[model samples]
Target chain A: MSVIVTPTTTGAAGAGDPTSTSPAPGAAPGAPAVRSRFTRGPGRWVVLVLVTVTALAVVAPFLLMLLNAFKSPSDYSTNGPLSLPTELYTQGLTTYWNQVNYPQKLLNSIVISGTVAVAATVISLLNAFALGIGRVKGRVWIIGLFLLANMLPQEALVYPLYFFAKQVGLYNTQLSVIIIFTVIQSAFGTYLLSSVLSTFPRSVLEAARLDGASRWQVLWRVIFPITRPTLSVLLIFFFIWTWNEFFIPLVMLISNSTQTVPVALATLQGDRLMDAPTTNAGALISLIPCVIFFLIFQRTLTRGVMAGAEK
Target chain B: MSTTTQTRRPHRTGTPRQSGQPRQPRPARRERSYWTYFLPGAVLFTAVIAIPLVYNIYLSLTRWSGIGTPKFVGLHQYTRLFSDELFWTSFRNSLAMIVAMVVVPTIIGLVLAAVLFDYLGRRFRGSVVSVLRATFYLPQILPVVVAGIVWGWILRPDGAVNAILDAVGLGSLAQDWLGDPSFALPTVMLVMVWVQIGYPVVIFMAALGRVDPELYEAAELDGAGWWARLRAITIPQIRPETYVVALTCTIAALKVFGPIFALTRGGPENTTNVPSYFAYTTFFKKLDVGYGAAIATVLTLIIVLVAAGFMVFQARAERKDA
Candidate 1:
C-alpha cells in the first residue's frame, strides 16, 4: 500500500519536501522497460495462450465449485462434472444453509473477525507508535522478540491456549477465538507498522507536544492520520486471515452454533460425503466473502501480499 | 529494507537532544516515557502467546488425558515419540511436503514469474499480468477448507480428474485419489503444490519489478539466452525475496492442517498425516493432551530453529554484501 502522508494540520508545512517523513522509496532498481512493438508475433501468441490456459486451469476449481453449486445432486452425478447445470437449483443451498445454521455461523465469523481486525489495528498502531516514533529504549530487542513470536507455528501455541482459554472461561465462545486471532495477527501488524513508522520525523511529534498535547493526542492528531493507508492494509489482512482461519476455531469453538463459517463448512464436509451439491454450496458460501473482498480490494490486497515479503 | 533499518539506528532510540542530557527539560523527558504505550499490546501478547508457549513447554513434560490433571512424567512423552512409528511417518510426510510445497513450487513460481515479468511483460497489457497474478493467488486466498473440498471433488474416483482421464482415453490411469494408501499422501501433496505455487509466483513477480531492466538488457546484448539472464541476473537480484519465500513456504509446509483434516483425515493407515494434524488428532480424538503438546513443542522448536537459521544467514549475507 502507498503510504500517503498528508499534513493534516498544515499542508504547506514542508509538504513539497517529500523526503521529510516518507519512508525510503521501495527498492525499485530501475524504471520499467519499454517493449519493442515487433516483439508481438505468432510465437508470442503461443506463449500468451499458454499463460492464459494456465491461469484458467488454476482458477478452474473455483469456477467448477460455483457452477456445481447451482446443480441438483442427481444432475451432478449424472452429468459431466464440467457441464453447465440444466437448471439453477437452490434446494441444496437452502438445505445446507439451514443445516449449518448459516446465519449464526456467518454472524459469528463477522463478529469475531471484525473484532480482531479493529482490535489488532488499534493495538499495533499504538505499539508501533511507541517503538517506531516514540523511540522507546530496547526497541530493537522488542522488535526482535516480536519477530520470534511471529515465527512460532500456531499449532504449538493452540494446545496450551486451549487449556488457558478453559481456565479463563472463554473456551467454546467467540471471544476466545477473537482474542487469540487479535494477538497473533498484531505481532505482524506491529512489525510492519513499526518499520514504516520508524521513519516518522521527531519534529512532527515535538511540534504537537510543544502545543501541550498529550501522548494520545499527538498520536491521534499527528501520527495516525498519515498512517491510515498502512493501517487499512493491516486491517484487510487481519480480517481476511481471521475469517479464513480454520484450525483455532475448530479446536476452540466446539459447539456447531458457535463455529465460524469455515469450521461449519468443514464439519459439513465431513458429514455430508454423499451430498456433493450441498457440499459445493457450503464451500461456495464460505468463499463468497473472501472473493468479494478480493474483488473490491485487489490492488491493496496485492500490495499487502508483497509488502510482507519485501523485507 | 536494509537502508531503513540502518538509517534509523542512531537517531531511533531516544529524543534527538538526549546525548548530553544534563539540561534536558523535565516535560520532554516525561513525554518520552513510551513504555506505557507498549503495555496493553504487550500484556495481551504475553497472555495469548508467550505465557501459553511456556505452559506448552511444561505440558510437554507430562502425560495427561486433558481431563482431571496432567501427570508429571519427565521426558517420557519425548522418549516414546522417537519410537512411535506414526510420528516418524508424519514427520516424513511433512518433509515430503517441503518438496511438494516449497522446493518444486519455488522453482515453478520463479520460472513462471520470470516468463511473465521478462518475456510477456513487454507484449501483454499490464492488466493481463495483474489478472493472471490474481488468478494464480486465488488458491492462497480461498479458504483452505474450500480448496480441499474442491480438490476432493476433483480427485474422487468418479470425479473430474477421472472424468478427464476417461475422456482422454486413459481410463486405466484413473484411481481413487484420496482413498488409496499409496496415492493418498502424493495426491494431498499435489493439491498443496497447487495451493502454494501461487504465493511465490506473486511475491517473485513483485521482486522482479525491483530488478534493473538494464542488467537484463546488458546481458541480452552480450548474446546471453533467457536461461543465462535468469541465472546471472534475476536470481541474484531477487535473492532476498527468494529467501523470504523459501522460509515462509517451508514453515507453511511443516504446519499444514486444514487440507489434511478436510481431505484425507490422515486416513489409509496414517499415510497422509502431518505433524500438525497428528497433534490435533492426538489431543482431541485420542485425548492425549501431553503427547499432543510434546509433538507440537517439537514442531515449534524445529520451526523456530529453521527460522533462526534463515535470519542469521540473511544477516551474514547482508553484512557481506555491505
Candidate 2:
C-alpha cells in the first residue's frame, strides 16, 4: 500500500501556499504540525456522507451479485436478485461448475493469463532497456510507433487476425491468445518501464561496465534486480488485463475446451438465460481471480496507472 | 554503402585484434548493439498488431466473408457505412457514453479527490483516504463480464433496483431499466460512470500530492472556501492528470464491448449499440467482414485523432508548467 500512502504523506507534508506571506505550518515541527484549513463545520459531515454514498453506489452491483450467487434458484426467481438467502444455497453454483467444467476453464484462464503476464514483462523489459537507456537510433520514433499501435482499437485487428490465424494454423489455440496479449500489452509495459529507467542513474550502469561485465550480463544481473518492483507492476497489469480480455479470445478460442474464463462466462450466459443464480455463480467465478489479484497488487496497479498519467 | 563497409572492415577487425590492449569500445559500436535488445519486442509487435492492422485496411476495401479470397470493391464499405443509420446511431451512442464515462467521472473524481486532499487530508489519517479510494476503485478492477452480469441482473424489471425502489416508496420510479430503449443507454452510461470514477480519483490524488498545500492554505487565508480553493488551485495543478483521464476514458468508451454484449447485446432497438459492439455483430454475427473492417477503421482513426489532440494539449500544459 506504499503506492497509495506515499502520495498522501508527501502531499500533507508539502501542504502550504508558496505565495502566502505568513509562514505555513508544513515546514515547521513534526508530522502532525503540518496543517491548514482543517475539516470543520457541518460541511465535514456532508462531505463524509456524500463520499460514503458514492462508495456504496460503486460497489452496490457486486454486493447484489454476491448476495444472489448464494440464493437458491427458486428464491432468486421469487425474491429477485436483492434478497438474502435463508441459508447458503449452493446448488446453482454446483450445477454451473459441473456443466461448465469449472476446473478446466479455470486452468485455461490461469495458464493463459500467467503466460501472457510473464512473457509481456520479459519482452517489454528488453525493449524498454534498449529504448530508455541504450543509444538506439530513432528511439523516439519507435516509441511513437508503439504508442500508435497501442491506441488502435481492437476491432481493426481482430477480424484480420482471425483470418490470418486460420490461414497460419494457429486458430483455436491458447498460444495464439498468449502471443496476441503479450504483443498488445507490451506497448504500455515498454512505456512504463522506459519512463522508470529514464530516471535511473546512468552511473550505476557505467560502474557495472567498468567491472568488465558484458552488456547482457549487466542488464540481467544489475538492471533486472534493481527494477523488480516496476517489472512486477507490469506483470500484475498484464495478468488483470488479459484475464478480463473478451473480444480477442472470443474470436480466437472458439471451443469450450479452449476458451478462457471470460469467454466461458459469456457463453454460459447465452446458454443459461434467465437462470439468475447460475449466471451469478459463473460471474462470481470469473470475478474471484481478478479480485484476489487486485487485493494483492492494488498498490502497484494504482502506481502503474498514475505513472502512465504522469508521463 | 560499399565505401562505408570497406572503410569499417579494417576498423572492426582491428578493434577485435586490439582487445588485449584494454581499449574502450567506441560509443557508436556500443550504441549499435542496443538494437539487439529491441529486436524481439519490435518483431513481435509488428507481427501481431502492425501486420494485422495493415491487413485490416486491405480487407475493408474488399467483400470477404473471412473465408475465401476477397473481392476488391474499392471503398464500397466506407460509402455504405456513411449512409448506414445504425452506424450513425452507434456513433452517437458512443458520444453519450463519453459524457457518462469521461466527462461526468472527471468532474466527480476531481471534486472527491480535491476534498480528500484539502479538507479531509488534515482531519483523517492517510489510510482512511486510501480505503475510500479503494472502495471507489473496486468496480474498475472487476472483470467487465462480471460487471455486465451484475448490472444486467440489477437493471432487470423485477431486479434489485426495483426492489430497492419499492422499499423506499419510490416504486413508481422503477422501470424496465435495460429493456427500454430510452432508459437502456442512460443506465449503461451510469454504470460506465460508476466503473470509471475511481481512475481519475486515484490519478488526481497522486497529482494533488505534487501541488504545494501552501497554495490551498494561501487561498483559504484569502477567504476562499472549499469550492473556490478547488477552482483556483486543485484544478489548475491537476490539468495534465485531467487530460490523461479524459483521453483514457474516451478511448475506453469508444471501444467498450463486453458490457454491451452481456447486458443488452445492443438491444432495445439498438439504442445502446456502441461502435465496438456494432462492429462485432457485423463481422462475427452477420459475417459481413468488409463492413466490420470499415467500422473498425473509422473507430481507430477517431481514437488516433483524439489521442493526438490530447497529446498536443498535454505537451502545451507541460510546457507551461515548466
Native contacts retained, all candidates in order: 0.50, 0.54
Candidate 1 structure quality by residue, lDDT tens digits, B1-322: 3224444565546445644443534355455468889999999988998898898888889988887888999999999999999999999998998999999999998998888777666555555666776688788877888789888988888788898889889999999999999999889988998898788777777666656666877787777878998899989887877777788888888888988988999887899999999999898899888999999999999988888898899989978988
lDDT at residue A231 of model 2 (Cα atoms): 76
Candidate 2 CAPRI level: acceptable
Measured against the true two-chain complex, the DockQ scores of the candidates, in the order shown, are 0.34, 0.40
**Inter-residue clash pairs, candidate 1:** none
lDDT of 1 by residue, A140-204 (tens): 89888887777787777887888888988989999999999888888888876788787676667
**Per-prediction TM-score:** 0.90, 0.88
Candidate that scores best on DockQ? 2
Q: What's the TM-score of candidate 1 when only chain A is evaluated?
A: 0.83
**Candidate 1 at A86: error in angstroms?**
2.5
Off by over 4 Å in 1: A1-38, A299-311, B1-32
In the order shown, what is each candidate's alpha-carbon RMSD?
6.2, 7.4
The whole-model lDDT of each prediction reads 0.79, 0.78
Ten contiguous residues minimizing lDDT sum, candidate 2 chain B: B1-10
Candidate 2 clashes between residue pairs 3 or more apart in a chain or in different chains: A15-B213, A16-B213, A16-B214, A16-B215, A17-B214, A17-B215
